[model samples]
Target chain A: MNWYRKLSIKQKQVVWAWTFLALPVLFYVVIRFYPTFGSVLLSFQDWNLLGSKTWIGLENYEKLVADPVFWKVFNNTFIYLLLGTPVSLLISFIIAYHLDKVSFLHATIRAMYFIPFMTSAVAMAWLWRWFYQPVPVGLFNNFLASIGISQLPFLKSTFSALPSVLAPAIWAGLGFQIIIFMAGLRAIPQSYYEAAQIDGVGPWTVLREITIPLLKPTLVFLVVFSSIGFLRIFDQVFNMTTNDPGGPLNSTKPLVLMIYDTAFNAFDMGYAAAQTVVLFTILLLVSLLQLYVMRERT
Target chain B: MKSWKKTIIGATAGAVMALSAGFAQAVEIEYWQYFYEARVTAIDTLIEKFEAENPDITVKHTTFPYADYRTKVAAAIPSGQGPDVVQLFYGWLNDYVEAKLITPLPTDAFPPAMIEKEFFPMVQAMKKDGAYMALPTAVRSLALFYNTRLFEEAGIDGPPKTLDELVEIAKKLTKKDAAGNITQVGITTGMNAQDHHWWREVLTRQFGGDPYKDDYKTVNYNDEAGAAALKWYSELETLHEVTQAGFMDEGQAAFKAGRAGMHIDGSFRIGALKSTRGLKWGVAELPAGPDGMKSNYSSYWVNGITSKATGEKKAAALKFLAFVTSDEAMQIWLDTVGELPAKPSAALTDANKADPVFGPFINGLGYAKTTIFANESGQRQVIMDAMQRILLEDQSPADAVAVAAEAEQKILNEYYK
Candidate 1:
């Protein structure tokens, strides 16, 4: 007790700093880490909401591996992540780059691009559902008919359903990614561009060499977040497909939707928990790999 | 800070005084339901009448959309924030009953003679352990909805009365382009939950096989009759090609646009269809199976007063439940919502007899039956999921039937054990 009281004022200051820093860390552990650990533990037990949980060990994991529907949903999720991420990034980057070029109306153009992000996912999904309707009264079908094309199966066909759902996700996501890219573009001092100009660097050359390299961190962050978002896709599949998750022959089924179906619809909490663990592990590993690749490049 | 504290104290005293006055004077009951627009308007009108009759009690009504009602109730009830009374779907009764989340109505609360006289026997089958789990307010049954214009264009005289005739007429009504891509379908095979149940029931009944045995311990969906029924359903899409694969919503849109011939759905769809202009539509009984068996599946909404509620709250809730199920209140519900009344006295009224839109539903009550065998919600979902896989994914009927039977049996064993 005497030693504690005799400590230096600098020591007390360090202790106070540590306490302030620990508050948020403690909160993260309690709220996020605790529930995640509980979910993983739940994966090993057979639990209905009201009943006593029985220990089943790896049985749920085994069942998940054998379940055909699980594999179907996993494939669908990867397809979405694979197709959705790069396309969204490219489109958003281009829009951000163009908006950056227009200094006068940049703020207005940015707000216009960001409005979709501000809209609720359910509202957007409903609007898109009406847009992709198969009848002539449907917006997309009417457009097709106007161009002398027969009505296409936008949301009704197995082949088109995944892409149709992806369209809205891309549309809603572009605003945030565009803002990030714009910030990254701003961070690159004009001196580099002026230097490149003196050296006779073309627009494409400047983009390839200086702009993209400088924006690597933002690109990496966007890719990781967007991939995670696409992997856990649920709302669009649920709302746009008439509450039929994985509609059109399980073509739009994603990992999170499958988890919900298993736990809530099928009441197989243990199996659903197992699926969640698997999804969490996959995302963790993929993100780690991405981080390593980015580090290596740097 | 001192002034703020004083204000808080003053507000707290005022709230306590208001609460004491409310409790001492009249019962305020919280009632939850899923209704919008016309149904909401009808319910609001009924509430005004109810409040007039029971001047001492005030009912606060909350509304949710039909889709989110189950989840909202489940979360609310567990947290003890649920309303004193809730409108429940018959399918949801088993889960809530098993969880003991609902209170059983006192036997004397509802007149037994009135129940026997007014309600269909099918609605009574929802009771568990000799206790009526819910009081059904409205009943709906599956019927064949035909596009009158399309039927006329196809030269079909009227709706089919037999399975073979339905297929034949459906085939004639289907329109295809030169490349053989189906532009318009004849029927949307699996549009709603009742449609799936209707198919299963008609097939099981026709095959002379019980889908679920009397004990409810076994599911016989893989039996010969069940298999035969499923095979025939598959033939509609695969062999005869009257129905298109992966085009259920498309088919519904087509039917709505006067391109398709028939839609198998519940009576609830009539309201939405009626809202459309210049569309001639008619409802008829589902075609009988080849074995001449007519199996009509019915679904309904039930209102149950909570077992947890007590004193004035309980009394008020029961009063509201009785009011909603009463002939007068049911008349308002039926007239506005297009749903058939669960009460016999209400169903037999002139309003019901004269309404052409609801005649098929009322008449179909004669052959009405619920899926008594697979009453468990889990088993029902499993069967439907399997059915979706088979119908949508082009899975082998035998394989789908086996998977469904196995899943159903597993659920039964789990629960019974």
Candidate 2:
């Protein structure tokens, strides 16, 4: 009691700040920190989820390097990020830009676009799978056939498979991204557009110079957010190719799916943990790289 | 004096009734299984019957969806908690035994000699180190399930018995639109993406070559027979042009719609085919490979007792197991589940043998072989990937098989180590 009374004002503020921070701090330690470090430790050990873990050190990493499937899946993960993010981002921005200017049935139209994002990913993946099927079966193929178009092997061919799987994923994400872009568009001052009009600058010019420059923060946030989502993509690939997940010679298999297969299907926990660590490193590097590249100049 | 004597007798009788009630509190043992409509109903029915038969032993049943069944069981069993009697796929039998998660049924309980004498040859897969760790009530084997109406439309008399005849029938049955688009396929060869089982388990055997040898440690499919089998499978799409990748939609779409002339699938699909209205289908033994050998893949999901079950709980679990594997239970399982009885005596009845639909699957089990997959799911995917190369990417069957063999060999080596 005497020591508590002896504390200065600065000391009291420090203690108060920590008192408020206690729960979240404890949560981070238990829920986040523990598993993370445990996984890292586990990457260096062999475990079958049923046996005692043995320290095998670097062997898991060595095997991963030699594993051909890992390389294929690594490329697939990047393809999801490289292709999915930009394509979805562009589509969302276009919709949002046009949508912001609209007055009639704006809410309804916005809701329509947002519905896909809110729908369950697994259901969306399966629905798109049906859409990608060939003639007399798929809606897309039937429509093509009715109009005298060759049936596209959307989900079957290795060349077209990733994009086919990616299409629904991009579509599913558009609603959320569009909503974000719309919010950002709405936040911009009307005065800038008015001034640009007075200057007789064209709409495209204003869009490139003012609207985009002002929306940098939102763009950065969304880019980082969607990039991570694409990087960790599993459900879409898993459900769409449920019959042959990551198939057509593993053209659609991603890092997360590979990690899952190694852990559960193969019961190679050590190898899976190694893949997880690689995924973590990739996520970290990609985010950092994006942040650095997109940094606002001083 | 007479009234006093009567009261004493009544009190003694009452005391005896109380003592009996105390002893009959019921020993409850829980059973866990994967959720399929038929499976759930069958288990519930068995529980009702078993409970009625053993009034003192109460059996509680719980189920999870198929996808999560193995993971749920694996996680729960290690904590000394979970069902006393659990259902496991044969692929997982080795792992469970190795981990000591399941107790091998006491030799005294089901003598080793009795096992060989009574059960089908496939039941040997249930054993580890000459001890029966788990036993299945029902077993399944792959068979060629064809749409009978489609065959009639194609002007085919009956199911083809050999690979050459199948190709001839496929060419005849196929239909095309004006633009060269395949509107209806003659045969949806189960050789695309996920349909690798037909190629690996059944065809590999019928082609007169084994998939693995030296205790599943080495890949033995690098020879002439394996390549020939794979080449024939690839040619179905590449050269034959009768069955395309899109024909099946990679999800049994073509078969269910009756657009496919022939489908090679397991007996497990019988319920679905039968339930689909406006569809007439029949099951036949898979067409023989070049060597003229008939082979099929047989896999079983067995009920295993956990090591944690002990004393009275162990006794109750054993009672449930015995009841479920009994001839009566096997008959009920056969009638309800559309799977063959595991016991040879129970399955080989004249009525069952002569039945048109179920006959092929039952008879195919004579030469059927269960997978020795250490990681069955993983190994299946590896082989499937190999099939995809030949079917989709135009890779040579020899190269594809070799690559797949190497990958599978690695998995096997890792497991044994």
Candidate 3:
């Protein structure tokens, strides 16, 4: 107590600031940083879930490099990020742009879009899986058959399976992206659009010159966010192909699903950790690259 | 009269005190299994009986969804937090053993000679390092489940006895629409389902090819006979056109919806099928191959004591394990779960052999084989991929089998090495 009374005001404020900051710092160190480093360490070891871990430096990474399935999974993850981020961004922006002009039943319409985002991923995936089944059982196939069109093997064919899985994933994320885009549109000053209208500029010019430029920050955030989401996709693919997860020659499998299979089904924890490290690295580089490209350039 | 009343009150008090003491000293053991309705009910009943018998021990039964069950066990066992006695698929024994997740049952409680004499020969798959790691209450074998109404409508008086006859009857039973789409398939086909097991254990063997070369440590099903079997199986969809893959989404679903004339499934399907109103179904042995060879695939879920169990917990777990595999429990399991008892003594009674629905499955036990899988999920994926390659990629059956053998061999080598 005597020592505290002798302390300077600056030192006392520093102590108070640290007292508040300590918990979260401790949390990030223990919960986040510890496992991050531990997984990196584990990548150089050999362990089943139950047995003792033995140091087998670089073997897991070597095996991963030589593995054909790993390469396929790596390719699938990139496809999801590249395809899912752009397509979803464009669709959601189009919806939000047009939707902002409408006034009747606006909240209800927004709610409808948001409902899918709120629904359980497992349930949505299952519902989509049912829709992809053959005629007499599937909704899409039945509709196609009724229209005298041949059945499309949406999920059964190896070539189309990955894109088919991606469709629903994109659709499910559309609502969230649309809401974010709408908020960005709302944040733009009315004066700029009013001035553009006064100048008698076309809607296309206004959209290109004013709306999109103003929405760039929202676009950047969503691009990075959805890219990470698509890269780490698991539940949708896992549930959609429950009987043969990532089936049709592993076409629809993503990196996280492979990590899950290695960790649990194969009980190869060290190898799974190695895969996790790879995924972490990919996420980091992808985010960093996106930030650099999308950074404000004024 | 006063002294007699005092004595009676004193005796009552003493008994109450003893009962409370017993409750205080009770050792609780946890049991874990995948959630299946009938299995959960059966295990619940067994737990109640076991608890009643031993007042000093309580058994806690926990179940996870079938999809998450393996993940739960894998995550929980290493932390010494999950189950004392856990139920695992028979095919997972090698994995469980390699991981040291389960301890072998005590020989004094379960002697080797007695197990060999009483249990079916296939239960020997649970043995490792001179001890039995697990014991099963019920066993399952695949059999033909034919819709009787469809059979009668097609004018087939009985099930086929040979492979050729099966295809002929299936063609006759098929119904098609004007658009050339099949409305009712003669048989259901999906390698993603039980067909993988059917192919590896039954069809391959019937066609004179052994699936494995050395106690399931080597992949040996890439031969001419294996290709021949693969051709026959794939031709059912590509050539015969009596059945199609992905019809009505799943084979069992199609059969349950009465759109499939015949389905091949384990005896476990019996309980569910029996409850479907207005559906007439009959069970039969799987048809023999061209050489009159017969084979069937048998599998089971076995209960084993986890390695974490020791001293008091071990004693309680062993007692619970023994109780579940006893004759009474086997009877209860068979009645509730529609699976055959693990032991011939409990399963091969006159009453069970005479039952129309269960008889064929029981008879299949005589020729049943359990494939010792090195990596069950990985190997299943390989076969499924091979089938898809033939059906979708237009690859030859011979090539598909060769590729599958290589992939499966890789899995085997990874596990065994």
Name the best candidate (by DockQ): 3
Q: Residue A297, candidate 3: how far off, in angstroms?
A: 0.8
The reply for model 3, stretches above 4 Å from the true place, is A1-17, B1-20, B98-100
Model 2 fnat value: 0.60
The weakest ten consecutive residues by lDDT in model 2 chain A span A241-250
iRMS per model, in Å, is 4.7, 1.9, 1.8
CA RMSD, predictions in order: 4.8, 4.6, 3.6
List fnat per candidate, in order. 0.08, 0.60, 0.62
* lDDT (Cα, 0-100) at B353 in candidate 1: 64
lDDT of each: 0.79, 0.85, 0.91
lDDT of 3 by residue, A1-298 (tens): 8987888999999888999999999999999999999999998998876678899999999999999999999999999898999999999999999899999999999989999999999999999999998777889988888888888999988888999999999999999999999999999999999999999999999999999999989999999999999999998999888777887788999999999898877778899999999999999999999999999976
* Per-prediction TM-score, chain B alone: 0.87, 0.91, 0.93
lDDT of 1 by residue, A29-95 (tens): 9998998999999999987553457899999998888877788988998999999999999999999
lDDT of 3 by residue, B70-124 (tens): 8788779879889999999997766678778799988999998798899999999
* Stronger candidate by lDDT (2 vs 3): 3
The estimated TM-scores of all candidates read: 0.85, 0.93, 0.95
